[model samples]
Target: MDIGTSVITPSESAEDTLPSMFWGLDPIYGVFAKLYIKDILELKKSQPVPGVFFYKTHPITKVDILGTIVQKRERERFFSFGVDDGTGVISCLWWKKQRAMENVRLASSPFGLNVLEQLNRINQLENSNSQLELGDVVQVRGRLRDYRDQREINSTSVSKVVDPVFTAQIARMLELPYLYRNFYDKTFQIQMDSSDPNQQGEPTLSLQRKIKQFLTQNGVKNFYQQELEAIDSLVCIAEQNCVSLCLHHPSQTSQDPPSSACVSKQIHELFQQAVCALQEEGIIFQKVAAHTELYLVTDAEKELHKVTRKIVQDDSTRPKYVDKGCPFHHIVSCVRHSYSAGVSEAAVQRVLDRLECDSEIVSTMDRHYTVS
Candidate 1:
């Protein structure tokens, strides 16, 4: 039965009168008198209560949330962004797998032109089913939330847009062959020395030493573009300047394809590894002001290596897919090879959940063939 809608039969009441919220004649006392009993408790408190439905497990007061940006960190694969209604704020997490959504743009510019752009986008969002973004002023409907680390939380409804703007800086790399080809081509050109077949068609001993020396001296280590972006994000965040880093994954590359879930997991795992590595080296990460950016200090390279090691460890645990490659391989290519592949957010969440539960291997267990 629904908490609020559950009918209390006459036999259940002592006097055959409906329970009233008024005092004196019919007084409501404690959590038992509320229409929704389960909606009023906390998780820590809910653990001790037996037979309580998940819905009634925690009941929080609804508060107004206004003027807040919904943000998800690059390293934290959690898809939801938190927003505030005038009364309270809640975190809204997305679960869809295939759709690619960007946050609504909020204009930071003072010029009327930029403001007009935001206004136009806001109007479009009013009719669209798209999610809110960086510069949206929306009214959220949910209960006030509290967590161990957080004092206030909310589970919000997606409704009522007030002001909308896009206030994010995304790095978009355009592959203009006329402009970037020279720089791009040099990275992949043949540095290997080899002499053309002699006119006589005889093996030339004279070219062997030069070729060997060239091969030994020059080498290339390919890196995924996303990995490079991840590293750049860390550095940018470490500087304590940017809110988030966004990169455009090139479509022309023939490298590995990335699943949505795996990419998110790799970023988060890498972040955790980076934090751990920093702690080992005496570097520390401490929270600054509320809802503000995070800071990383001391040796950046060491922290990066910590993130790298975590990525490597995570890569080893991912299962191989039949159509696309294994999630781990995709991640490895991103982190180690600097390649970018398109991945859905849902796929990323699946990978993160697997990592959290340590059940990725179970997916492969079902695929094993029985010997005859």
Candidate 2:
């Protein structure tokens, strides 16, 4: 069944294919394809899906990118940075959870805490960010959006990278070529059974779609990539259920469900692919801005968003938040108290970043946020 060894299946004629078919059912559509900014800027818009861009045969709706902030302009709601990835430069818009204007408004009363306390708080908050300075590197994972005839990254989450040795940026730089040559540029071997995704389609695609639907519908707050105990362990749950069904009901084989036919490693990789795909679409996130393991449903995490927002809203520029907005540590403590002890600082941080990116919360400083 794994006959797809080449880019284009020779049997398929040109007349049999359409661009939308590539956009609709291909697994690449779900991926936030990693490509050079030059390629991204050069890719023509997909005729079938106006929002999507095409890199040769690849259909790209989103991207997971790393670039340097070569130029920047801070706006009321977002920060506009000109990001250069060596290949090209593109405008990257990172919307804030807290605005600079709000900071000016909240910090109106400059005579509050001792100078040391203020400095300490500022340092503590700023420890999480490199002050988003020019020349500093940032990782932007979001959709490819064009505004005013200019291509830009409408980032879902933007975080400053602490790569003193440039390890992460370098690794991505080395990895992209292999991915492009082997995966992105290659044409998929079409399934002759059903070209349309709407009709009964590939089981793996089906499962991914189902999980995405589940996250979207339930507004699932959080999940784990490897932890089985996680409440919203989509990958783990599917794997457990599938393997269990195979053992319990010997008659129920993987052929009936292509997703189950693979080995444990394959299933894990596939599910992880699903998770990554969801990440590309902004349906699920990798984790907190500072942390990297927990995965969250983007549409989900609402209640947590509310909890973090309230901490800033009720106490902005007050004693707990001082005039600077709620400090990161205070916000963490509040989240643990209001949400659940089970939530970690990383998770809270993720929630804060999520809320901020959505403009549900605002932070004028590095780690502090004032809810708007």
Candidate 3:
């Protein structure tokens, strides 16, 4: 792979190896990390599988990347392409079956089609049957490997991007920075299974217990998944009020604080399991959708559920909404105006979902509710 320039190192010890750390890096197995090639090169491979790698706490076996094809070499069953994503160059192996091309050899365009559509189909077929060209901007998703002492990707799928406006490329650039800062860049500490039998009301000590205790002790009525303060709180509870991420950069002295941290894989697993168990037991629930990560405890908002139901029932009979029922926004507006101004669309959405689940309300159409 040709980089066209010398590789840039972030620090003096960036390339130097740290102590082999393999524990608690297994939960993220099969998660395809969207990352730059430079970060891929620096991934710590402590897991047994050759393809598995870790960046701090994220375990990655597969990755998807966007880059320009700088070089290409054809082989018998597969072809290799050198990809440059501005950070570095990495070789990607893309495999293909020759029989796919041999099976569908379209002689001419089919009947029920116009000139433009037929031409586009034929052009797509020809493109699929051809070799990749240099300077082509492409998307590659694959497992990573080391061959001849070089990091490379064994690509599972490949497609040439047809973006005239740089939309996809720009979108990728914008999205990856958030993921990098929120996930890939955060480090975490290795926690011990400390069993403290001295506590008066506590049960058997474990990671799940610790995290749950943290939420309860701190009175964290709600928290999002990516909240660093919550992550730090759990870490503090586990490690007894200490900044616990153990990433050992070369420049750090004995007194340096742990920086930009997250939980380890085991802690991450326990944390999620605890949250799910809490939700299952009705101790906590997300105020909105799961993607929002906005969790709320059982009595956090004192539950405007009954108020919302009455509002929906009363509004559904109004002259304007009698036939079509009440729109969802109207219910939200009523709940906020009457019950609480801080109520979110998602909270009202959850109330609607619960009402529907209990057969208390019927959905006439999209977001329109009526008394069941």
Candidate No. with top TM-score: 3
How far residue 224's Cα lies from its native spot in candidate 2, in Å, is: 47
Model 1 worst lDDT window (10 residues): 166-175
Q: State the weakest 10-residue window (summed lDDT) of model 2.
A: 193-202
**What's the true lDDT of residue 342 in model 1?**
26
The digit string of per-residue lDDT tens for model 3 on 117-221 reads 565676677458446889899998889888888889998878889899776786688668767865666553322233322221121134446655666777777
lDDT preference between candidates 1 and 2, better one: 2
List runs of model 1 lying over 4 Å from the truth.
Answer: 1-64, 73-78, 84-90, 97-128, 142-156, 163-372
- Computed on alpha carbons, the lDDT of every model, listed in order, comes to 0.33, 0.66, 0.66
RMSD in Å for all candidates: 29.5, 18.2, 15.2
lDDT of 1 by residue, 1-372 (tens): 112213333233222222222112211111221111112332222223222212221221343334356564322332456554233444554333332234555657665467656656665664353455675654444443445544333433445455333211100011122222332122211111132222111111222222223223433122222332355534343222111111112332335444444446434544444443433333333223111234333223233334334553544445533322234334434433431122222223333333445532322221121111
Cα lDDT of model 1 overall?
0.33
Model 3 bad stretches (over 4 Å): 1-27, 47-49, 100-130, 189-372
Model 3 scores worst on lDDT over the 10 consecutive residues at 1-10
